[model samples]
Target: MAGSSQKDRKKVGVFVQHECPLNLLPREIWSSIAVMVASNSIEDLFNMQATCKEFLGAASSDAVYKHATMSYKPLAHFLLHLDGPERRFLDRCVEVGNVDAILRHGFVEYLRFGRRDKGMELLARASTEGNVEAGYLCAMLLMFDHEDEEEVKRGVQMMEVIRISRKLESCSKFFRGVFNDAIVLLLEMFASE
Candidate 1:
């Protein structure tokens, strides 16, 4: 009976020693997989991280955060009130040049908090990174808010590019609503001036 138990134990140990094929994949491949998972659903990425140490490492990559489609709704709440982990996650996304993160933070900073320069800088960065909504907002700000003729001309050119690209037609309704509200606010600001 003791000899039979020893043989079973050895078989179990051998099975445990066999590595998963996934564990053999390169870190770059894992990172790419993590990015895809993150883009699909950040929640899934978080769940993946809990699966194993290897997945946790991959999910923590900056590339994952950069490509992740974070929920903008929670971000709005975070903006109004600081939440530690969420704030840190937002900061990581922003640091990695996540376009949506930049756009949201820029919009809030510029429109809500009156941090014009910083907001414009972030907006411009997001626009340069291929966010059509940020491009539109930046053009609007440059055209209406700046007194400099050169800045106005640049804004006009930017708007022209956006129109030529037809990106505005495909933009999300949420962004369009935000854009319209911003236009109204800008008009009010100028009217009061």
Candidate 2:
């Protein structure tokens, strides 16, 4: 078999070792694994991407993108250059009460697609569920994007509500710090009075 042609080896029933362990996985299984990482950690994403071309493609597969969402800048940036069938994957982010998903979806709608009111609505939906970041974003959007005095006033009211909500204060001190900044904006708003 020495110096045999590539076909000769196959005739002898030689098992060829090809690709890495992860890459050897069924595309569906690999995508399943990759999707699990897409939602929570960029490092996990990069790790999966480093495995092989198969894994790299799997990392960006719609199954993974569905869970990952465009909230991640890389995913959003990647999706931007894509066309047709892949664009549908962008909206697959699950809506099952993941506040971050809600806020991130809102971010994409406003920043990427320029759908201001649509984005604000998504953020407001998250905020209503007691997400601090979502509330903060909703207030900011209302304040900056809307020219109506009523909208700014509504934003200010939102800030004040977020700042003092005992439910938020009790659960997340990190968010409490963020929510408090609303008071500064509120104070600045009222100071002109």
Candidate 3:
């Protein structure tokens, strides 16, 4: 009886390994699911990746990173102080053209670190990708800081587009606060000069 039970257990294990429903799903389906998970919370995405090799592969998809909604607080901390996995995750998101990541990184680089040119490049990329906050910041920076007349004209056009679209009215309070802070910082920067 014991020997037969052991044999049955072996068969069950084999069946479980070979017939897992999740394993049967296509990679594209897994990637789509990962994107949904990532859109909700990046922490949940990390937990999903820890589940199994297949999930890990799915969570690593560029679509997942691109669509992931990284919250502002943790992302800000990650940007100010580089940690191991968090930094890598941020880098991957930026590499995959995550708009929020690009915008925040650009803002820090431009305002905090004083790498204006690189920051502007990143901000422009994010704005072109349809990030409203990035568009606002880029417009402000170009209008206020650039010496070139054409650059100022371009910034005016961007601001005009944003105003006509009524995007400012739709902006979250958090983003509005950020815009206010940016204006103050720009004022301080010029005042100190």
The most accurate candidate by TM-score is: 3
lDDT of 1 by residue, 1-193 (tens): 9888887874444345678777889988999999888777656777889999999998899888888765434334434443565567667889998997788778768867889899999999999998888898899889999999999999999988988997756544546655565566667667988
Better of 1 and 3 by lDDT: 3
TM-score of 3: 0.72
The list of candidate 1 runs beyond 4 A from truth reads 1-16, 71-82, 144-153, 172-174, 177-193
How many residue pairs collide in each prediction? 0, 0, 0
TM-score of each: 0.68, 0.46, 0.72
What is the TM-score ranking, best to worst? 3, 1, 2
Q: What's the CA error at residue 175 for candidate 3, in Å?
A: 2.5
Give the lDDT of residue 138 in candidate 3.
90
At residue 142, give the lDDT of candidate 2: 88
What pairs collide in candidate 1?
none
Task: State model 3's lDDT.
Answer: 0.79
- Model 2 Cα shift for residue 68 (angstroms): 6.9
Give one digit per residue, the lDDT tens place, for model 2 in 20-81: 77655688987887877776665677777887788888886656754563344432333133
Clashes of 1: 0
Higher-ranked by lDDT: 2 or 3: 3
